[model samples]
Target: MSGSESSAPAGQAAPEALSFTVHSMPQPSLADRRSRVLGGRLRLLLVLLACAAPVIASYFTYYVIRPDGRTNYGTLIQPSRGWPADLALQAIDGAAVAPAALRGQWLLVTVGDAACDASCEKHLYMQRQLREMLGRERDRVDRVWLITDGGTPAQALREAVEATGPVWMLRVDRAVLARWLAPADGQALGDHLYIVDPMGEWMMRMPADPTPQQVKRDLDRLLRASSSWDRAGRE
Candidate 1:
């Protein structure tokens, strides 16, 4: 037998085999990738809006759905001013307190000397009564007495303040306070009761020597307006 012819048995065939090649998918272009990312972001934003719809709708019902001619008892400060961060302030215990720390709740602020005269007592009384009138919502409003002078508050005044409930007795510079809380024309800061919103904007100012009934109406409106968003306490 010849060397090449004798390699396989007669009439026998070589085994057959099959093979395949795999091709990877093409990569996405930059524009396509950006569009996919934007689509995901839009979906996330839509979910957030759905979660916040109740709060947004409640505010819309109070502010936009109301009649255009309605008037508020308190004067709305045009171009609302925010609390000053740099103002020097201290608590009754002589501990330093940042002015901005007073945010996150409604504030009824009265500014005067530490001596606290009769007029000052009257203002403090009105503040306490107004908050108590709120019932369950009283926690949402805080009473703030900003003493502008260096003298410590009198013992009697301190006792009276404590009897009124929680009062944030903070001492601030007189000149610095004048820049933020202003009185009506022909009046002083002590003459008016200032209202600060939960977000720290000084939004309203009650008239000098305002009647409790009128102030109550204004506060009721505010509480109703903010019911959906403002909770009863700070963090």
Candidate 2:
């Protein structure tokens, strides 16, 4: 082969190889690549932050703010606690129900048997009356009767309950009931009315004989406090 012929083949090969390499190994610009990485990191950070927000907010609200300044009517249960994991609860009509079902609405719960006494009746009356006093916001709260016994409720009791649309006659296991909402030294479960938040957490318990005015005040304060996060109903 001649010198010029060899040189031409070399030149042709060099350009062809260079073009092939350019097409084979495509690369993004520095700015575009950086932006993609940063965007992915930003999305991951946002997801982590979203998951942590509720715990952070609750700690901030409960610990940072001193309850000393606030005058609350209901005695805040010392060692504010929650229901047991295995809390056995049933429905009035013999169907099973869980504590989670109590979520999504404020619960005004009273523990008693179907054969209610004077105290039981009094608490029941208070529950209904207190809810009614909430006016337009009454529907946001539910009056729940945690009946420990399996005895069926009487027709008269049902009639009284029907008059109040927000009432629920629940049948919870007695042992589970005792585990939670523990009564005073001599008091029975039927004595006092307890307050449970919409989150299935038993937040507060009233005195054995909670006056209507006191309960109304407590309810008002709770409504005011939760107004920021909670709406009128579960939307």
Candidate 3:
């Protein structure tokens, strides 16, 4: 064997030495990791805010931007009550109506028995008139008659409702209806007209026997204020 080579077994090949190279990877700093996490959370928050912008802008217009400098005639419902998801409403034709489907337009709602007495008729008339008075803005409002009774509505009531073009005639349980809509002092739910915003929030209640002019003023203000965010029809 040469001096530089070590001898092994006479017939066996020599084994080669193994070599390894170590390379260290840099770990992210705590501040860098925290900044990345914070950036992701901030992005998620911004997306949520963007989704809620329309609702927030509408409310801001109603509460903050009073163009006419006149107070709302309808009593404002602070922290407005949202439409009940479990209402199980039914259309006049007995079709299932989803509460979510009622969103995306202003709602002028009236509650009463299927009989639709004189008071009910009067409120329905006012609802129709108020919507009509909006003229070009009329498409922005929807009239809803929530029949609390179970039986079929009276033929006269049905005919009257049909006369009001595109009115949403729906039936809801009286007990459930009461939980969402209320009347003024010494009055029934049938006495007042409820104002639901485009977002399905019951935000205002017109007084019992409200004057047409007064109700129009309130409706006008809402329509005008929400013009920036609210559109004419439901999505």
Candidate lDDT (C-alpha), each:
0.85, 0.76, 0.87
Q: Sum up the clashes in candidate 1.
A: 0
The candidate scoring highest on lDDT is 3
Can you write out model 2's per-residue Cα lDDT over 1-235, one digit (the tens) per residue? 5577446465365444434444566789999999999999999999999976764565345435635565656656666567888887777777888777777778898888889887888888888899989997787798899888889888898788668685778887788777777766687777788888777667777888988998888787776566555565665
Looking at candidate 3, the ten consecutive residues that score lowest on lDDT are 1-10
Residue lDDT tens for model 1, 70-105: 677888887778866667898878899877677778
Candidate 2 stretches with Cα past 4 Å from truth are 1-68
Query: Root-mean-square deviation of each candidate, in angstroms?
Result: 4.6, 6.5, 5.9
Which tens-of-lDDT digit does each residue in 110-192 have in candidate 3?
Answer: 98888888898999999888988999999999999999988777777677766858888899998887778888889888999
Clashing pairs in 2: none
Q: Model 1 Cα displacement at 208 (Å)?
A: 1.0
TM-score of each: 0.79, 0.74, 0.84
Candidate numbers, best lDDT first, in rank order: 3, 1, 2
Pick the winner on TM-score between candidates 1 and 2: 1
